[model samples]
Target: MEGDGWRDIKVVRNPYFSLRIVPTVVPMRYLELAQLYQRLEKTTLKTLKTRLVADFLKKVPNDLLEIIPYLILGDVFPEWDERELGVGEKLLIRAVSMATGVDAKEIENSVKETGDLGESVALAIKKRKQRSFFSQPLTIKRVYDTLVKVAEISGEGSQDKKLKYLANLFMDAEPIEAKYLARTILGIMRTGVAEGILRDAIAEAFHVKVELVERAYMLTSDFGFVTKVAKLEGNEGLAKVTIQVGKPIKPMLAQQAASIKDALLEMGGEAEFEIKYDGARVQVHKDGDRIIVYSRRLENVTRSIPEVVERLKRAIKAEKAIVEGELVAVGEDGRPLPFQYVLRRFRRKYNIEEMIEKIPLELNLFDVLYVGGKALIDEPFIERRKTLEGIIEADGWIKVAENLITKSVEEAESFYRKALGMGHEGLMAKRLDSVYEPGNRGKKWLKIKPTMENLDLVIIGAEWGEGRRAHVFGSFILGAYDPHTGEFVEVGKVGSGFTDEDLIEFTKMLKRLITKEEGKRVWFEPKVVIEVTYQEIQKSPKYRSGFALRFPRYVALRDDKGPEDADTIERIAQLYELQERMKGKKIA
Candidate 1:
């Protein structure tokens, strides 16, 4: 396509809100683009001139002028794909190359001349050509598949390979196609749309309900599956795929209960209460001698916790089994240590043996997922718990979690208080008849934290920060639930808990959605939901809603939750009541 033709399509694909203008499509050709540019008005021509220059400037090595466009656009980096590339390395290489255009051999001499690749790309593009190569059609499925393939092929030490692959993919793509390709590859869509937006788009494209799409995604974690099914059997094909046994399902979460009484009430008098441990959630899969340890997200973490793998291989009686449990670090006294201590062991690289010696872990078994090559997810919790208890032998390295079956909510509440007194989080309330359902968050499993405070907040806006927060979004402004109007009311802001690196990364992220400016802040469409943590809940007149959180911090961004699922003002009031009651209490 002509450069102008590509630019026209770009304009059409990315139109400003309230603008209904459309561009004419023309045959792809450089000469045609040149002609179109010549016919354009001075103002239009001036706007097109910069991009044309930028395209030319990007030929330099280590120039961000070349890298920024690619990052913003999302294109394949054939140059870096020889291996999987870390976020830092990829950005550095792109920046360096765009800045100096010098070969590696000449970088030492040119480094002083061009400080960074981004600067170079910006400078170069300002004076570079308007057109060169065109890109392939971009889609979310393609981007996700490419990442998976990269992860599969690169294994562990393939950073160069990954970047090279990305370069090759984007080398010939048109600038606009390149943009989406780059964004998709990074697993981010900064165009004022949250991750859920893609799910919504997929549902609309497939003509199916959001729930159907969600169920399919939960089962496969593969966006391509949805697209494939839509292409084959239409949206109905999504429903055709049902939850199957023998396949691991997402475990249910629990709410924190303040005391034994509280636990019993939530569980409706009778309940199966398990000691909520301060540890990591692990799913052990065993097939014959082969063993794998997966995290709650189904990520393969076998290598990180080899000791756990070895223990599973030795302790489990079944030849083939999959079990869910908590892996906690234990002190010499045999008591479980804090979760942070356990997490340090996960991040260890050098001196792993020494770290392992210092931080021994104990696996607290809960549910058995599979046994004898048959899936146990369809089985009731009581049956699965029995099977789990029967198969795993308690050793110094592994033991079954402390569990009890009680008919009174009072007993459950007592256990909750004991768990807290032991420096644990809270208790897990599970339905005895329930089966494991992977990736689905529902009331079947409720996590009862000690605090009554919970807020249902909507993401109203986000800001880009400096240093490490330069690229991704840094902090967000969360709004409260307005019961009367059923709308989100701006309440508080959360800017802490983010690392310097996160600030830089997220800043670049939020920049893409920079819409209209409001004083020092930029507003975004309310879409994302996040569950935040706080020391206490207090009434405040500063916000539109009379509430505020003390020491509020980002807990987890809730992609599964829609805006409507957020906590209400009434719920916040309940939490405040609990907080007040606990303030004056002195444990005997």
Candidate 2:
């Protein structure tokens, strides 16, 4: 047992690399990170968690520090990057089963017992009867490199190859290490160490202010790069991080308002109101002749919308700029379609050209953040609007979002109603003196939508949460009643706008009504009623209801209402028709 303990702590020399590579001689073992994971798992206090990660990061060598942030996030690449491991739960289970000589049935049973596949694999590996003698001990770099190779594997027998790489890692990983290795692969490393916590940890570890770390992260959208900058050049190096053409920055966000009058009041009795077009938020980055489009999540979607790329190339007169807009799909009559049509086009990976022709899009330019190597994020809204208007030559398909500058509350309300009448989602009210703040949901910007359109839906099911929400069900499966059939049909899932206390309370309520369990999803009897608000009603075939809700958010528990009192499919249909008629009248 003493010899085995020493072996577990021992840093084995790698047979894969030559002795000439100095770093290979002192390879950073995976045990260090595994130990950190164990500590973080046990350390529930936020301050203690941050301290553990900060100390752990400080111990990592500078060369390996670059990937540490990504590793901490349970990812190899930044969120903005397009690389995916493509390893599903079943594939991972197969790999684990193969590596440990555990029965596939035993693994499936373990998964059923434990809500998480990571925990299941760990249990299985701990009880495994066979072990490989020739396997090399895992290292942090080796694990990351193998996953990247798995992500790069494609075309014919890719699953087999991915499984093989995962098996290789499992064969060498100790039981504790295998637990986190599985979680990392599944992208559910639930140590409660999110990006924000990691940001604070990075600041503390490098002795820089949290603001500088945040700014560097905002500009680059890559924690790996931010960590590298923090380690090498300190605060001065972080200040050098600027808006570049190819890298996409996080889009600024807004808080929803109850009323336009309230929104205007929040903006000091005056605000710039723009029609909130019901479409995907897009950020266009132009460098020389190259045009790239990024989604709100900072995903590169340029290839998905070729027509938008071409239109933007001709619409913008700037040499280099980063502009934000909404890409709304248009009907054959040139009227903007519902947000779902645009979303479908955005999601398309194959036959994209066909979809582009079938569903034409109109770019609605709204804000400018960067131009001519200068970041306008610090500029006031009025100045940025001026700069945006000055540079863009609006064409029919690439026009600026319609706006109304108003100081009076009545005018703001009227403009908001007009925007909703025009089939827009809502009105975005911005303070005239506010600067463009990326990744912030401050009071500088407010989204005003009618709250009278709330729906009382039944909770039919729920899925287990991850990270900070690991113990409770974070999102609830919502359903609308089909009165004709007397059955509940799923409309969508609601995961946002719930407080931690609410989640805990609801989780206890859901546990009592659970009728069946399938993986992380727990199907409950339709007893709990909740009020929900959504941006739009979209036609979708993904749900049995034949409809879906866009951006669904929790309002409050409708304790006064029963499942029978829940909103029906008929009501949903009526809302959809009413929405269409409102848009039609505006078009006419």
Candidate 3:
């Protein structure tokens, strides 16, 4: 046992390797969680996923219940917490190599082969050359706390320190645990377990209704805390977790609609049509003088746009309120600029004043979730919109979104055209009687945007589809030809608009063209062409092309076209310029 890297705790001076591993306080072993992750990954059934999680949560001690949900969701903190591991794939490979005494190049090759960093790390840990004697079995609390410490590390020598901590954890983790650990840290734990499934699990574990759990999650934006309260105090405790003024509520999302006529029919004819500005989705929370701004992903972005903060503080009449809106960047002509301009402001950290000068933003307030001491989320949208309008005096910087209450499709269509002519993306149709359902894409709201131009792009890569399309390719990574460089540059990924027959045909076609495989991504020879229709072209560094298509959907396979004949980057630039020129122009 001495030479085999196993240590007896009695003989070891520091048994847990600098970790405050309190044996008595340990509630659930990480091995158990890892086992659950395996089971979840093996199946795609929602019911099975719910049963597995519910059964696991039922066995969790109340004291450790809070972190369980977060861990299962592949995060140590909630989305609104503003903290992240910040460790990239390179750092992870280095950490895994350091722990397992494997060559870094070998680890890289393994990742390339599997297309999954977690799976590669897991395999490395299983075949490690050396291990520490005092390696302790990981607990849920221990793993969560250690990961938080890793994320919180910053400044000089933080990378080395993070690597050390991660290596230590890897030493203690079993192969399966290491697999899930890497996935969790990388924020790619695709175990087919969604938050909706987790909500159901929490409800099942506590013997409460799923609606209660979802309501609690919507108001709090924290499923972990929701699970704990439900486990301890049941429904009564859950009911207490209501909307807070300064805390961001998950903004209610809308489903896409084919047209205004269909949207009106879906909402019983009578509906409220509001201009859907092509900008950032913002949720503004105000308590006294403090105003917090959150993005659509629930990331705290208060510091990015101070102008919006000042405007909210000055305009909001109530002492405490929560409002939702679209933040658009406008040019000197007082016309809305492209969404990309606003995104630049959103991403700007330093040189805020310069960015503000470069791009002035206007907040088009729409829905109010809280006012004074009352929670308006459960209230009707009509009432909420009224409260929003009543609480804020319309100003240049902040104003309620231009809305018209209509029962006719023709009226809605006219309004939508006017909005589009005014440079907005489209219109949002809302049921007047529907309540504000935070974090849900319920039938209460429908988004209507007219069809835009389609691009025939080359298939550069594809990912293995999940659930029902598990055997076929579900999503595709498309690229445009860079005429200058003679290279294909990625623009966006599309997973929608494919028929079952298309999926089968495309899967077979792409599989045959696979140049290489890595994780879920399969690099193709770029010989295939596909037609894609998108809402708008925006400047984004997220893709290699330095541009991305918003809501890009597949139109059809361009068998008539080849990769060499695909759209060029020049065309994308021209389209973007055309869109910009159309803005602030009179639509005669």
Best by lDDT: 2
Question: C-alpha displacement of 274 in model 3, angstroms?
Answer: 3.0
User: What are the Cα lDDT values of the candidates?
Assistant: 0.57, 0.81, 0.81
Tell me the TM-score of each prediction against the true structure.
0.63, 0.73, 0.71
C-alpha lDDT of candidate 2 relative to the true structure: 0.81
Evaluated at residue 144, the lDDT of candidate 1 is 41
lDDT of 3 by residue, 331-404 (tens): 89888987667667766888999888889999999988888899887788898888888999777889999999
Q: Residue 138 deviation, candidate 1, in Å? A: 8.8
Q: Relative to the unseen true structure, what is the C-alpha lDDT of residue 82 in candidate 1, on a scale of 0 to 100?
A: 24
How does candidate 3 fare on TM-score? Answer: 0.71
Off by over 4 Å in 3: 1-26, 254-272, 405-417, 429-432, 439-588
Model 1 lDDT on a 0 to 1 scale: 0.57
Model 2: per-residue Cα lDDT over 168-192, one tens digit each: 8897888888988987886667575
lDDT of 1 by residue, 1-588 (tens): 232323344333344565455666433332222222233213223223334433332221221222222222223231212223344424433533333243333433332344323233333323333333454443333444555566556356576656655554444334434433433454332332222433555555446677877776555444444545543465678877653333334455543345565555555666688888877787776777788775554445566677777878889988888788888888887777876676676656567778778998888888886787566777998899999888988887788888778987666667778877876767777778877876544445666675654454776777655575455566678876664543456667888876766456445544433434565566754555776777777789987778887777875554335454566576676667756656646343
Provide the lowest-lDDT 10-residue window in model 3: 1-10
